[model samples]
Target: MRIAYLTIDNINDNVILAQTFPLLGRLATLPEVDGIDLFALRKHGGDRYRAYLPPTRIRVRVGNNHGIWHPLTWLHLVRFALQAWARTRAGAVLIGRNPISLLCLSLAASRRGTRLVLDYRGLLSEEYVLQGKIARRGRMHRLLRRLERWAIRRADAILCVSERLRERTVRWQPVAAGKIVVIPCCYDPRVAGRDEATIERLRGELALDPARDFVLAYAGSLSVWNRPEAIREVFHAFRQIHARTRLLLLTGDLEAAQASFGDEAAIIIRSIPHEEIQHHLALADLGLLLRDRSSVNRVASPVKFAEYLACGVPVLVTPGVGDCPDIVRREGVGYLLDADLPLSRIVSEIRANRSDFRARCREVATRYFDGDAYRALYGELVGGKAFRRLPESPSVGKACA
Candidate 1:
């Protein structure tokens, strides 16, 4: 069957490349898929996505996304819908959570008996509200929630990034629970570990003090949702215990990072290529995946969580923020650090299990980040595993369960 997959994220953005593109590649490469037409809301980087598109079987279209509340944004989605109706006779529609896309695809799917799939990473309205971009009771927020409800009910299948997120989506349509599939933002196994030589080379290039510094790195966008103050607090706390520890920020939002940490005791980096991030992560003894425990963050499956694990870097994560903490605890690969953990205990945990954590963390990452995990889950969601035959490993199911 031909599938028309759409993401609300910018196609060429580092975020999409990390999570969405790998899955898109998996789907497009399948023999049963005659072709897959991918639609995106924006294009941040030039020519990054072009090399990945298989010219014959996969086609892509991206639209304007200048402002979130802009009327033109809605018009752009409508235009994408129109384009989809005109250019593709798809049997299945897979969409990332964008209300306008949902509204348009509902109409498009109804006419063609197209299977509708919702990739509900997090509730869009809740994300905005938690980030202080919108009021929970405001007209736009309520309207988007209404649209989200409609989309949830209309979708033939649903994919949630976390199990908690799936439970949250059930509040919208309890009957649709049967169709929901848990597929977290996964990591690419190819870049799982970096050689010490390469890591040391990069350390020199980036002017990092390889011998003295214990890099505590955070990679991904520095959004309004992130607690930069909290990051600093934790870094300082960790540093007080382990004097060699240094905060490393690898982010696209340099301005925001600077504003929060202006020439402070941290190493700031511009957004590097997604493929190169794993190598940089290898330099970090601990990776940071700290976020506020709001409704949105509680359900988020941060891609960086898996990326860190893939690079054999243990994480210092906040509690009750989706599956990461549980995975960390179960695997003994990371620390679920409280804001007030004592310095002595913190230092002991780090110094004692450093080697064991590195080995086990990579093992746990292999189980969670395998692309086939999502491929199998998607196949189950769409009612068949016949579409793609990637080898199924039992370890992932065990790890996630």
Candidate 2:
């Protein structure tokens, strides 16, 4: 079976390298897949990330000239859809990585008896309101919802990043629920190898003592929903009890992170190359994933959750981030902060129970966020066969196979 996957993202965004490429690489390995055509409708104008594309088994066509608000953006979408539709063979699968992409291809999907798959990552409309891009339930929000609904209704299969997201989508479009499958944002634990020299060097640069200082790390962007202020609050609270505690902010927005935590000498912020993130995360004992409780976050799956666990760094995440809180609680991999748990106590518990955390967190990563299972699911989705869910995961289980 052949496949076409489309997404609208800035070429420079890390998701293209970390998320998209990895996913396509896995799908290309499936025996049932003949080849894949990736359509990247970049929202900006650059080819800085083009060099990172995977091997030729997955052909990439990047459309990198139109901004989201540009008058020609819709026309560009139509033209791109036509190009994708023309390239597809009969019975080929067309997968949209977002709502707008699928909405554009809905008509084309029905033409050649091809399967349409919606890769639902999050609630885009609610996210726009959270980011102040559009008002809640306003004109633009309603329009986006209609488009999403249209796409979801027409999809032959739907892939959700979290169970909560699947549930919410079911409530929104009850008839489409049966086609949706939950597949969280996953990672290959092999990417997070221990490098003692790199860890020591990062410690030296950050002025953190290997024996005395405990590092709390927050990786990824400082998006509005991520609540950088909440991270700062947690860091300060930890420092109040343990003065040697240090905060490391590894983000792409270096200037914004510096502006937020510049006055604190105990805090270190830097924008480093993506390849070096594993070593930097290795330096930390705990990972911070704080986000405000909103509809946007309620059904979201942040890849950092899996990244932290894969690195053997237990998370200190807030409640209501997809299925993360439940996973954290059930798996004993991290602490979920609330009005009940004191900051000092949680830190003390973490420091005392540092041993064996690496093993346990790695186990959780394999059980819940393993990439192999997702690859199996994607294989089945694109293979034009009846969907058969795999058994729940055990140790290296085939939950989606």
Best by TM-score: 2
- What lDDT does candidate 1 reach at residue 355? 76
lDDT for predicted candidate 2 compared with the true structure: 0.79
Worst 10 residues of 1 by lDDT: 392-401
Question: Compared with the true structure, what per-residue lDDT tens digits does model 1 show for residues 1-401?
Answer: 77777666777776676666677777765656667777787736766777555335677888878766778877877777777666545456556455556666665675565677777788788877876778989998898888888878877776677767777777757876666667778885556757878887988876777556667889877786677888888888777777877777888778888887788645555566667777788778788888877888888888888888888888889886888888887777777878465755755666666677778888887777767656555555554322322244321222121
For candidate 2, what is the TM-score? 0.94
CA shift of 330, model 2, Å = 0.2
Residues 247-271 of candidate 2 have per-residue lDDT tens digits of 9889998888878888678888878
Query: Candidate 1, residue 14: CA error in Å?
Result: 1.7
lDDT of 2 at 377: 71
